[model samples]
Target chain A: MTIDALEQRLTDLAFDRPDAGRVTARVLSLARKRRRRAVARLGALAAATLLIAAAVVYFVPAADAVLADTPIAGDLLRSAGLTGAGNRVTAVGAVASSSGFRLQLVGAYADSTRTVLLLRANPAILPLGPPSLDPQLSDQFGRTYHVQSELTDSRTGQVIIEFEALAWPDALTGARIALKVTTLKRACASAPFCTDPVSSEPMVRGSWTLRATVGVDESTPLALPAPAHLGPATFNFTSVRSSLATIGIEMSVKGATFDDLQQRVADGRKGTPVFTIDLFAPNGDTATASYSLGEDQRGPLIQFLGYRFGPGNYRLHISYRGSDVDRLLTVP
Target chain B: MEAALTLSDAATAALTPDELCRRYAPSVCRFAGMIAGSSSDADDLAQDALLRAVRAIHSYDPSKGSPEAWLWRIVVNAGRDSARRRERTRWIVERLAFTAPRESESVEAAVLARLRDADLHAQLRLLPHRDKTLLALRYGVGLDTAEVGAAVGLSTDSTGKAIRRALARLRARLEVTRP
Candidate 1:
């Protein structure tokens, strides 16, 4: 069956008119304390289910076997500042580390922190569209993340964030991030929806450029190709704390394309941006650097990251710059 | 001084609460019914929705369409809020037991009915829930810009912009899915 037809069928499932009943005393009763009680019961049930599952996992040998019992297995993910509530057996989130002096470290450079978060899928959830050859499935990862890039009042220090799940628990593997833009259209002025280039909407006109990057110890900074419009928008970042390790991530707009800007982005050549961030370990050895695109359009940029960390407190950071055809990289 | 039954109703034509409730009740009930599953919850949802409509009535713009469509908007918004709560509760449970309401019969019914009430509702649901609600009220419920703004708790101008954006998405989805 065609997808449009499939969508129609799915949409129809929610079309029933269930409220044929009159508001008699009985109906009122149903609306009364009953709904509140039902909702409360649902909440309680959710709590009870979680507690019981935790109990089972605690007592079952299989749980231990699947988790941390094996050599080079689940043990001391704690050292990398890793922890998890349950096996979450199947997960897809990326544990990112940054150079934020929030942990114990005998590391190389940049303050360091390591953190892991979990995200999962809702069985009823539907993707806005079909998956592509390299579809960005951030939502399905064991944890979902939110991204934000902020230029401090100083206009120098960028506090870019790769937010993990509300209560994520894991360790750093690499700095994973994603970006997407869709539903671009031209507004017809005369008719408000004229698709003709002559009549497309001005509001929808002009190409958009976006960029992000991370640098060590608040060192790297981007050379803005053009001026930017700043605002009071707050960047909220969520994370689940694990070991004493700390990880930091930073993002910023580097630049945009002018002619057919939207077209370039859709073509996937708006230039796959890069991340320049430093990684640190607790020990004084093995400090490293990483980027989003190793060289060119090599692979899927979603959560594909590089890393370096050692014993002790770890912190890391990512910095980037992107604009139309002009791509620039820097570290403060 | 006697209040005159003789007084022209228009001068004091504001509808009695009961009259207002009666007039818009069925559409609200229908909307809630489709959204909440069981006509039972729909009945309750409709009443609760009306109560909210009354409290927020001053915010309504007469320049918009008639009050009936506005009431349907209220019922839809109320039902959605209730569904989100239900989903969240289900989420907590699934996390613990690894079982969820999305697996249940009634929940499935609720999702289907809630999203397919009108041609536009079905179309919007295929896009995203946020887009669905935004468009269903603007076009399916046939609210004017001002009314749509009030219904969505957005500014009148913003409501139009939102509907436009949603329409763009709908077109894109259609284009991609075209055989």
Candidate 2:
């Protein structure tokens, strides 16, 4: 028989349709359960934040100082547990080593907002200069956790990489961290003052993975009440939070549709972000925020993970496409 | 409720989960049953797909794809999972029936003509899982090349070639069995 005959035969195969009302109810019920779980997770996160704030305020005036003073790797090895506020700090680390490099999961201590991983490479075998890695960390359900920043020490042959844990699923207290080293080149080529030969050899590639359990440290959120109207959309910054590794903005929008924000971009209106929340430190360094809209939008949430924010007051500049938004506020 | 009144199935990306299930459940169930090789599991697979779609609604940007295509992708994933579960069960049952004559042989004897006329169905069962899914979505569910490609994670050009190859392969199989 011909393809038409085959198509007709396949189409003739009968299957009894399920009850629409029952299936609809099941789907809605599942969606409701998912939302409830999310709210519960948010409640837990808020409680955790309050606990961290209390500990920071009452237990340690020099908490930031104490944590920052310890070597980045050392602090990861010995950070306080979340059993109680102001509990004695103890060292708990998740370490994974591969043939080429050793990875250490330091607590998210430099600031509580960012999770840090320390990579120690053999300097002799592969000269550690400016090496880049493709980092993939996911929960059991295949949701991705993103990295925010990478800091390297050429002298120590150690790289401290930080990732954003704000968007990670609640069920996953621990995540699978997969790091694929894309390039490991000689230091001479990348160092500021270099007279050594520039080697044209292919860069070294290696991979390592670890299951990183999140510790109970958190950064205090500062409310930044700045609202700006752009085109058909209104951008609102509800709060700002910082940790050792990341700076985040809780952003919401009003008076916008999928066509105006996402569809035009998908239809090739240029690479314009629906919302661009930029963080500017006092030192003039700035990091742009990135966001992902879940299928249901309760407004938009923009977070800048992996952007290194040190101890200082800062300003946040909000913009839409290329135009400036009116409500620029000093970050609390 | 206002949006429900205004938008067509092809127009709006923001169709409610209830609407989606009501509109597409029949075809989705048929597609699932074809891929699953049993109609008994089709309802369960369709329910699973709808559940997954509703849970992931936040990530569904209409700008990237149509809602129907998105639902098809979920149906394919759910159907594959169902097939795997059934395979495991069948394997266990086969091992347990080592002492008994195969009941499947007797069942086939009763439905011999139906199987022969439904040569496409028998031939589809013998194809690779991916090819079977591609064909099921195309001919069984009446999806176009682009929709089939979207559901199966293939490009339109590749999908076209794959359907042609699958049709040729099925034709060859039917020819080989013809008396």
Candidate 3:
């Protein structure tokens, strides 16, 4: 018989084993045990991880939303609750740990923002001392301030969440406090552009302000003049695939030409002279469909990998350092 | 949609691990029975393949295509890995021998041969490792040209044309002494 015929006969023969069911069960049991062991091993490894030790941080819950968890300290807060702010916080802290613990809470309107007041009247019980600088408190501004903060010092102030920090002392002056809220960034979880996986490389992932416009238009071919810093700067491409979504881009520094950008990715991760990417919408503005790139290879011949974001109209802006073509891209 | 099976077949699919053995245990044994001396390796590989399928069921999107094709891919790859590992541990020095066996010692001489043909294995070993792999992916595991390209890092256009040339060569060699 032919080899194909013989193979078919063998497949048929496989179905004839009277004891096959009994055998498969034993194999399955063994597999289950193996998987369980793997899961337990992984769980043990995760428990040993130290990085997550103090990451309980989130955007400071909005003052409007903070009442759910705040304590009803200080009589001033109680009076506000009586008048209507549900839970009143005349002070942001309290006094006493364990022994002889008595909390005296008072609130009085002073600053524009309502405040939490906690007084450990029993000095023996150890009231919270003066507001000292919490060196660990970061001054980084996020996209939104869900301020989970307590201004222990009367001089507390918030700004418009700017790129630069407004001086603490500058924010406080007598009866008024300024919210120097500069635009800090918190990448929206549901933000249309947040599909990029969170990675720990110092290179920022999600989104950034573009120095120029870049995207697609109905008639014009993407006419990005070569970036000024084109010589041999490096760049990256990162993407993911699941469901039906697909996205990909090749970023390179300016002046190197499109051929140069393509060649860089073709040579893999190590091909250098840095570059960056910008995507624009139909109206010549940054679109929600943007992300950073990463490499999936080790050596010079590594494959160029990127996410496949289904189907849509898109354009790209290439940025390279120290060159005329650096920001030469303009959106249609 | 769940596949509706006959009473016996339905029972087989739904069978408990122990019952699954009672029903289809022989299929694995027979499948394993060919290349192996005893049923142990067959049982082991078959069990492993099935277990993997069961565990990966949650992640298996049926929309991709046939589950059987997917399962078989895993099975064949597993088998190849096992073979390579065993090759290492045993370290059998199979010195290259180009000559064919005498024509007189035909299929007539070995009716109960475990394998389909010894010549097939010998000629397969003669191929470069990459070609051998292409053969396994194309025929043994039954991947289409596009799928094979993805696995072997070849473009689809190249894989199909290359596989055709490679397979034709092997088929011709096998048919040389045939009627």
- Top-scoring candidate (TM-score): 2
Candidate 3 chain A least-lDDT 10 residues: A153-162
Task: List, for all models, the DockQ compared with the true complex.
Answer: 0.11, 0.13, 0.14
lDDT string for model 3 (B16-94, tens) is 3344344434533443333331243444445554554445544544456444444445555544543453444344342
lDDT of 2 by residue, A1-332 (tens): 24555566666755444555655654564455312111112234334433443343334332222113224444322221111122212233555555444555443332344445555443311222221334665545566555554444333334455455534443235433344444454333332233232355424555545554444345567656545544445666666665443466666666565344553234353443544445545565544323443323665444343243345555454444432322233343
The regions of model 2 sitting more than 4 angstroms off are A15-22, A33-332, B1-13, B84-123, B172-179
lDDT of 1 by residue, A239-310 (tens): 212211233333222222212112212224333323233433434232331122111232112121112232
Model 1 over residues B1-179: C-alpha lDDT tens digits? 11121112244655544445555655565445434433434444565666556545555554565565555566667756545534544556434532211223343334334333354333444444455566545544445778767766788988878766655565454333323
Q: lDDT tens digits, residues B16-77, model 2?
A: 66666677766776676666554434445666777677666566666666777777887888
Report the poorest 10 consecutive residues by lDDT, candidate 2 chain B.
Answer: B97-106
State which docking tier applies to candidate 2: incorrect
Can you write out model 3's per-residue Cα lDDT over A1-332, one digit (the tens) per residue?
A: 44444333223332221145644644554434321111111223223211121111122212111122333333322212222222221232322222222223222222112122232222111111112311111222322112212222111111011011122332242222222211211212121222221243212212112111111111212333321222343232221111111122333322234434333322354454334444433233332222323333331111211121223343333333321111222322
Predicted chain A of model 1: TM-score relative to the true chain A? 0.20
Model 3 error, position A221 (Å)? 81
Interface DockQ of candidate 3:
0.14
Evaluate all candidate structures by whole-model CA lDDT and list the values in order.
0.33, 0.50, 0.32
Between candidates 1 and 3, name the one with more favorable lDDT.
1
TM-scores, one per candidate: 0.27, 0.34, 0.26
